[model samples]
Target: MKLIFYGEKLSNIRKLNGLSRKELAEQLDITEQAIWQYENDSMLPRIDVLNKLGQLFNVDTKYFFTQEYLIHKVSEEKIAYRAEDRESRKKTKLEITFVNFLDYYINFFEQNLLIPQMPIMDIREKTLKMLQETNEDRNECIKKIAEFVRTELGLENNKDLMYTLEKSGIYIVEKKLGTQIDAYSTVTQDGRLYIVLGTVKKSAVRRNFDLAHELGHLLLHDDVDMDILSSADLKTIETEAHLFASAFLLPEMQFVKDFQSLTRKSNPDYYIELKRKYLVSIAAMEMRAYALGLLTYQENRYFWGQLNKKQYKSFEPLDDEIPPVRPGKVRALLKFVLDKEVMEIEEICKEVHIRPDFLSYLFNLETDFFKPYLTTQKDYFGHTEVIPIGDFRDKTSTR
Candidate 1:
């Protein structure tokens, strides 16, 4: 049965569901050979099986018939910081699906709207030169790199980072990933970088640190094409990203001055006070203190011991009190387009060729969330893109 559909599309949907052909065959009560045939485009699923596939994957049945396949690249290296035990494959599979969804969402936005103009920023030559000269001393290089980025972004100190990034046309999205992986950074086909953050509720400080960490990857590892990175290479890059995040969040000079003022340097309570000012974790503050040479080797060891003894390693004070930050650019863009009657909810769903529920999951929004803004009839055939009326010129700003 030769159907005018992409077999690769079926394969992609199955992979997105994190299912092997045999596993999916079992679920569908079909033979593994049959599943392979469908994915290979040698056979078409019965209408009943197609409906079941749609229901199983939460995609419309038309999705299978659509000729469009995932056109962009998926970077796998940034997500491999995992235990090499039994859960390794499971975690990697989940990460793959998550990246797939992200790619679709990014394509939807970039293909549809043009509000945020993301310009590529690269300083690989200088960063590479400095690292080579410093004997790959990321500790020193990281501080300089962070300071350079802070200066370039005009960020003298801590401010709403997402607001700054969004104004600069960097798209940010928060996923409700409760997995061990906190976040990952990927570049689009057009050289636009998007940072995906994990929305592990009740810790805005951690989210802020994660964004800085990802920003570090985008800036410092500009040379890395994630498709070709090995696990060892990923570990090296991850370490560099961590160093950059630490230095970026708490400037060495500023952190040194602040740490000097702490009366009880070892106390988490003392660090908690700094957390309020620095918008970092009490624990991160303590580590930052050590990093800045504010704590001696003995003092750092003692502080770690204290952290263990006080049961502050996993659970810390103000974890609940500190509200987590969210990415606002996507949400803001949706509001602008929908409210301006530029596009309706059904229109977007149709244009994106995604199920409304799936779109909702991608954005961490409610199902039928856009249903309210849809005042007119469903106009799915014609693409109604909003034209840029006036361009904001001269100085560029993120917020």
Candidate 2:
């Protein structure tokens, strides 16, 4: 049977590489219009051009001809970006494409093992029911929901937030999302929730806060239409998520008791101990305290002054000391399948229509995962040695 070219796949791959028609054309030695035509199915590329495209994309030539089964199961409009900027739409498109590839990978393992159930679904339903029953305001409802989530997770302390979420079937992916974007969360059509965190060398406290904030979006705003939300409306939503994050990370009763121990309410340095205990930033702790009426307006103002004067906003005391937790759900799952011989790396690549390196890049996995499957050659002593598949991007210039 003859295979037909799928132009939409070309567009997805191009966007995934952060490339534009003009830029890709320049690299392929073709006109911008030609690149556009090929992407829009207006014309087919020559065999040489197709070969070059495969090489540039680090995929088999047949990838372009194959049916694109792996698609963005999660809608971009439903995504809750922590920080949306001018380039957010483009960044979101790329990230969602990456998610589709990862979802495809996870689906491959579904035939062999069962994925865990998402606990957040139950938490959301219970919270909504409670809201309908009570006369609680929005913020009060958020606080109650946060407390309920903590109870549902069986978390006594603030630590292990990421681990607990992962165990509950939320996939936490840490990628180098640029400065503008800190984190985002979304639920796919198949009910898989994802929290894609930006690996910007943040403090553990900040990271935990980001995790909780995304979790808030996943649980609270799952049904909201984010695409039509105006700037002010989005801000309100962001504030709500922030409130949820703060309340969830720092439980009211626990934080209140902890605040009473702080002798100097105006001193930002004094809260470092609380920071150490809760694994929360001093700034966040102070805000949480103030929200709980532990600190007065003047005291909060003084705390802010000292915070800025000392420049603890960017680089806090424990920012370097307390390392952020690395995401392991996807990595662990992939490793399990590989180690169990469920599927060989080479076979997986062929089946997924992806290069090993590209697959690794999607999940931010180390290339060492593929080292064992490298090509082998016999030495002088008849001993077989591994020949590493060197950098895939060495042929193409960096984007």
Candidate 3:
């Protein structure tokens, strides 16, 4: 029998868009029976019907005709040489699509309801230039970045900024998707952006790096038409993101001046004292010292070595004891919608563009942990009760 690719493609797109056959048929102005026939390979749609299907599903017509549909179930390596490349392209495309969708949704909500506008910062050019400038006082740079984010968003702290992002439909999930992957960010087809972190490297410093890197991708490279990063390119991107993150997290001039003043007494424990003030790793403090010319290369290397050898107390908490995972922005927004009754449970799942099963699993595993803290109930007697949903364990054992 000839392979009927369109049937599968149609079905996949329909499901991904969270549309039932009848619903899709209604949208396309076609009979529900026609959709059933098309999905079962009993009949193929005509060119007019194909065009309507493409528009309705927001997928390219070529996608239905190509063998790429069959490759979906194939082993990762056995697929086409460009499989990885194609997947990457698909992800980027989806990211842009989702971002646009979010922009629209945010606009709709603000106009129809009393929702606050989400703060958006376009730091792409600024971030790229930061990487190109040498002799840049790194600490001052970080401070400026942080101040910019704070001022733009009117946030007083990182926690507030995180809350705003979560409420604005961005989701950050912590999981080990793959080895050495660190983290990946993508906006779902329904317009929610997600940053999924690999939990293998649980160091707060590393997690900070991954978060900044993923944010860099979200802000700057989302429109770029490339998927795989070359080692050199990856390094360059990582460097830029690090600079952005550092500037954002640790403001330079303030930190430096503070460090200088704190160490002015020449106390042998000056570095240790400074680490406590900064909430940074000892290694980070050492780098800051070197950047400030407070320590020579030899001294910096020696201190780092000593740190690795556990000769001195490390500043940051141990990675194993305290992983850097946090509740993502996407979960926050979904919770808000559900709590506010702005969206029903099914609607929330549909808007976020996740399967009912997957959405339920994600909510129970991630959002349910903090549901109580985020929700409040009012009884008929005019008394308020706060329900608390505690921490959750991973439902997927392997992940």
TM-scores, each model vs. reference: 0.82, 0.89, 0.54
- Give the Cα lDDT of each candidate: 0.68, 0.78, 0.49
Query: What is the number of backbone collisions in each predicted candidate, taken in the order shown?
Result: 3, 0, 12
In the range 260-347, model 2's lDDT, one tens digit per residue, is: 9889999989988888888889988988999888988999999999999999988888778877787766766665566556667788
- lDDT score for candidate 3 against the true structure: 0.49
Q: Which residue pairs collide in model 1, if any?
A: 167-398, 168-398, 204-324
In model 3, the Cα lDDT at residue 191 comes to 34
Off by over 4 Å in 3: 1-116, 121-147, 150-161, 164-170, 186-194, 199-201, 220-225, 261-277, 311-325, 346-356, 362-399
Q: Between 1 and 3, whose lDDT is larger?
A: 1
Taking the tens digit of each residue's C-alpha lDDT, what string does model 3 give over 1-399?
554446866775565454678888898888999999988878988889888876565455655665421222211111111123334543333333323333344333333345443334334345445534736675455445545653554544332333444443445555433453566665433334556565564555556555555665555444443344454555554565555555554556666676667533233245555543443455555565576576667766666666666644434444344344465443444444444555544443345333334343333355344344334552221112211111111222221
User: What is the lDDT ranking, best to worst?
Assistant: 2, 1, 3
* Candidate 1 local lDDT, 1-399, one digit each (tens): 654756787887677656789999999999999999988889889988988888887777778777865664555553433222113566455556667666666565545555443432434345566666776456777889887776666665464666666555566777755666677676654566678777666476777788888888877776665546666766777778878888888887878887889888876677876787777877788777776768888878878888899898777877777666666666655554565665566766675456667766667666776766654554332233321222222122221
Residue-pair clash count for candidate 2: 0
